[model samples]
Target: MSIESGMIRWKNRVALVTGASVGIGEAICTSLVSHGMTVIGCARSKDKIDMLSNDLSKKGLSGRLIAYKCDVSNDKNIDDMFEWIAKNHGGVDVMVNNAGFSCKDTLLEITGDKMRDMLNVNVVGLVLCTSKAVKSMLTRGVDDGHIFNLNSMSGHRLTGILNFYAATKFAVTALTEGFRRELVENSKIRITAISPGLVETEFLARAFEDKDMAQSVFARCESVIKPQDIADILLFSLSSPPNIQIHDVLVRPCGEKI
Candidate 1:
């Protein structure tokens, strides 16, 4: 019902967020930690996560933030990270699959190796992480656990430049539903897809390999989605009553046409 009512249910819970070094992932970790949740932020760049942890400490956060080095694309890394979470925190009650990327190359120009790398990180990595989270929840008998996948507008509709990235997101969309169907029948676990359009993040800079172009894309728009905005939406979804499931959420800026 109310946002506060829903959020109260998650206080002191354990949450694991991928790609927590920056952008949406970082925002989610910050918000959850503020809400008295123990958050484990995982990323390939442990230094960035460590920096965020230190910043949160200075702010006198109500909860804790722990940084772990993890490259989701690597199975060994995922295994080790999940194992550490299990051993240290018992298990995760929330999982945010927010690590993803796109390259500047088009489908025609993209190299085989690059394409495979994208698939490995975007699809395989997400699936593996989801499996691990679900298994942990089951083993711990934590039926009310929630998993959120950071999808995109490209997942729902085809965009010329983002076709390849869209393909990976579309796979995520499918997996979200598939997991929901399979899990709800037996467990109370919840799965959600938070799809946003044109977020102001490092995603564009990395995608284009040009800072100016990324800034220009947002500069021309009247408004662009902010990482905190997505984090808020995620908090809302996670706050819902155990009986309710917020399956899909699509967000965009006020003036965003697509």
Candidate 2:
């Protein structure tokens, strides 16, 4: 089936994306807006989202992008954002839990506050978002709603230095499966875990605290996935026939070893 036909059900529907200011999150916002969805793109940096919205406006796409400022790590912020979404758009039909945080500090070097920061964003925040979205879907009688969690390859296997960050993603991996089990017999609500490796994004710079180092690492790689690539996979999963639940997707750039 054509993408248009596949996404017909989603046209003009309300969708919420966390961390929508940058990287895979930004690309997903662009893709969804182009596909004719009313996308609420939330990030701590609302200005960036507005800039993206402005850029997208010139395209005359079928859908629209709304900028929202939200720090997913904060419960009040998340609640406020969801409340606004519920009031303005009548609850979301799609939820993308794409916000994430990581630091280069290894287990030995990481502090309690830093560890909590990662858990708050990477695990707790994601869980809260998922719960809220599921509630919205259940209340609105929207059985076919979808949720996307931007997981990582690190979630599945241990990355030597980034082990703690990987641990949080590991929680996500288990949550994805556990969530699927909960929704199976009762609802058509779909949850997808997208695990990607070595994507060219601001992630590495943030993780390593050095843009040059991140660039050098990327230069060493033969190829790397683009943010748009992840967005495409998202659309692909969404467009699939409803019966086929795309449980998990593991993607890596060509020849990316470990």
Candidate 3:
């Protein structure tokens, strides 16, 4: 089916995306906005999102983009952003838990503080955001709302030096199923986990703490996934029939080995 036909149900709907200042999150926001959805892009750096909003405005999109400042690790920030969204947009019909981070240090070399920070943003923050989204859906009586969690290939298999980061994503993998089982019984909310391998995004630079290294890693591969590629996957999942629930999607570049 065509995108317009499949996603007609989501036209003019509201969507909230975390870590939306750049990369995959930003791409998702752009795609949804182009599809006539009111998209709220939340990130720690509000300026970046604001810039993105301006850019999207210049495109003359059918929908609109709103930038909101939020630190996913902080409960107050998450709560405040959600409150503003609720007041301004009514409630969210789609929630994308895309905010996450990874430190370069190994498990033994990593400091407790760093590991805790990773867990806070990747696992706890995601869970809390999901909770708020669920509550909003329940209160607003939105039974068909969908939630997408941005997981990683590391979540499914062990990767050297990224073991700790993998653990956090594994929690996300489990949480996806946990949420589906818990919420689907009472509501039609759909939960999906998207695991992509070697996406060319700021995540690599942040994880390596070296732009050159990040570039080199992608250069070695003949083809690497792009943020837009993942965004397209998200759109496909969101456009599925109400009876079709896409539980998990693992996408890797054709040239990627692991």
Residue-pair clashes per candidate: 0, 0, 0
lDDT of each: 0.92, 0.94, 0.92
Task: Judge candidate 2 at residue 171 and give its lDDT.
Answer: 97
TM-score of 2: 0.98
The residue-by-residue lDDT of candidate 3 on 1-258, one tens digit each, is: 777788888989999999999999999999999998999999888899999899999999998999998999999998998899899899888999999999789888999999889999999999999999999999999999999999999889886868899999999999999999999779999999999999999998998889999999889998999999999999999998888899999988997776
Candidate 3 lDDT trough over 10 residues, lowest sum:
1-10
Could you tell me how far off, in angstroms, the CA of residue 95 lies in candidate 1 after the best superposition?
0.6
Ranking by lDDT: 2, 3, 1
lDDT winner between 1 and 2, please give it.
Answer: 2
lDDT of candidate 1?
0.92
Off by over 4 Å in 1: none
List TM-scores for all candidates, in order: 0.98, 0.98, 0.98
User: The CA-based lDDT of model 2 is what?
Assistant: 0.94
